[model samples]
Target: MNRRPLPQIVLGVVIVVVGVVGLLRAMGLVDLSLDDLFSTWWPLAIILVGLAALVAAPRAWIGPTLIVTVGLLFQLDNLDLLDVAVGELLWPLVIIFVGLSLLTNLGTRGTDDRTINSAVIWWGSARRTTSQQFEGGSLSAIMGGIEVDLRQAGLADGAEISVFTFWGGVEIKVPPTWRVQVSGLPVLGGWENKTVPPADPEAPVLTVHVTAIMGGVEIKAGD
Candidate 1:
């Protein structure tokens, strides 16, 4: 069973609620200030975005977990519930996260594994997978970028890659013989597929499920 992404479901509900609220306000049935409400609860949106990333790509958890943590801190501070200043502590945390990611090879590295799990945070990564049996993988870019070349890889049956990009970008290069299917929810972001499928009806298919928040994802055929 294919379930809808949590982020997409939450977004739809939020949009409906907002529309209903706006209608009620216009009808004079309710008195409310959306600007003030948003100002107070804006951090929740960040938290949800992080959650969306986390859910979309669970293998790449560090970056999304950091995002959620930061969002929580901001939310607490916004409500005057935190003693320390978030701005003062965020830079050091960012440094630590970057260091950890680099050390773990999750931030940047080349892999020939059939299944790849990669996450890049606050930095850039370039990976070329040469796996003969290319399987699905999870890739994430948080305040960073990742370029993955799968042109030399071969897909067994059909493969699916899950991606999450928050304030970052992801570029994927595949062979022209593969059939590309790109589908996902983009929150203030977008994704594009530029791969040309071969004429064979049974051509290998590559399905990409992406959640982009204020970022972009591009899949194209390699030269």
Candidate 2:
């Protein structure tokens, strides 16, 4: 019969302990705050587990363990630790980690396919005679696309609108009567505006400034 090495046995024991503890915590039998665990003991745990894994399965787990250890170290707020561990080494470490993860998962794909291709669509319109105002927020639209229609909305002065897209497009349609000023490079495509009516001095002003990379963008008047 083959005997497992000491390091492998230790890793197995540690993993079993961690799994039991996590299960207990999830079932409310243990009263441990995830935040405290992650901010305090988790880093040390990660380091120890990583070291043990490196010794037991150097070919399989060394890279992942190192990546977790480094990430945990970076999340710590200690300036001294950051200065020593990061300093000029931050970008290089990030590049190496990303490259290795990509290489390791080269053949594995579609684990998060649904989230990768998700989008958001919104529609709102009002008559110009109404005193109602239109308001919108982009916090929910992060990392995805958002389509907003305000052409017929009876926009009031001081109406608030914010668009935040991390890596996708944002399309806003408004009456051409409103004055517009954009101050950001949105992908390679240019902004599109259609002719409508003269600007209403009392009408709310529409301001849109979006920042993105490699994401196509288009904005025009919505009828």
Candidate 3:
């Protein structure tokens, strides 16, 4: 399973936002203080985290939706738009929600594969099938990730894959001796080919055509 850790990026972004707010307060740009913002807007943190998980976990949305709804309720209460002790009841409800989400995830059939003909991931992870002979295909990812493990796969001569990514990333791990070519335009993004050089000049070729906008595509040599 390609479990791309999501919390670090989200947490780093949250930290930067908090730091910026602190800087503005120090510069006397706004009258509010950090503690004040935290007390009133902390629920938003919960909502953002839930959104990240919902997008990256590839699970049903029921759990994330409930968590988002609860965060909204608490936000409204903190804003004095509602009269409720949601903060006091939040932790217990969160515990229960975690249990429910776990139960829901237990129903999905997770498998390992390496060959992909076509796949779309909006906010999750996609893995290619493990077939040794791989045919080119199409992949699309928006705010998600796609991982292809080609260590056991062989390329049909001139095999090609078209990949489109927006605000997301794609990682391909291939055998050390495969010949790979990556060509594409990266708008506010990048393409990295870190595969080891092939042992022979007559090795197979697999071309990856990528369109990355505010995202990245990385080709790495597999262990």
Best by lDDT: 1
By TM-score, the best candidate is 1
Instruction: Count residue pairs with overlapping backbones in model 1.
Output: 0
Please provide, for model 3 over 131-189, each residue's C-alpha lDDT reduced to its tens digit, 9 standing for 90 to 100.
55676555555567777667767777667776666577888887777888776545467
**Which candidate, 1 or 3, has the higher TM-score?**
1
Task: Tell me which residue pairs clash in candidate 2.
Answer: none
> Model 2: runs farther than 4 Å from truth?
1-131, 139-143, 185-204
- Report the lDDT tens digits of candidate 1 across residue range 5-99: 67689877977998899899899999998888888888887888778776765655666777888999999998999999999889988887777
Candidate 3 weakest ten by summed lDDT = 105-114
Model 2 TM-score, all chains together = 0.36
Count of clashes, each model: 0, 0, 8
Q: Each model's TM-score, in the order given?
A: 0.83, 0.36, 0.48
How big is the positional error of residue 182 in model 1, measured in Å on the Cα after superposition? 2.1
Clashes of 3: 8
Worst 10 contiguous positions by lDDT, candidate 2 = 112-121
Worst 10 residues of 1 by lDDT: 102-111
Alpha-carbon local distance difference test for all models: 0.82, 0.45, 0.64
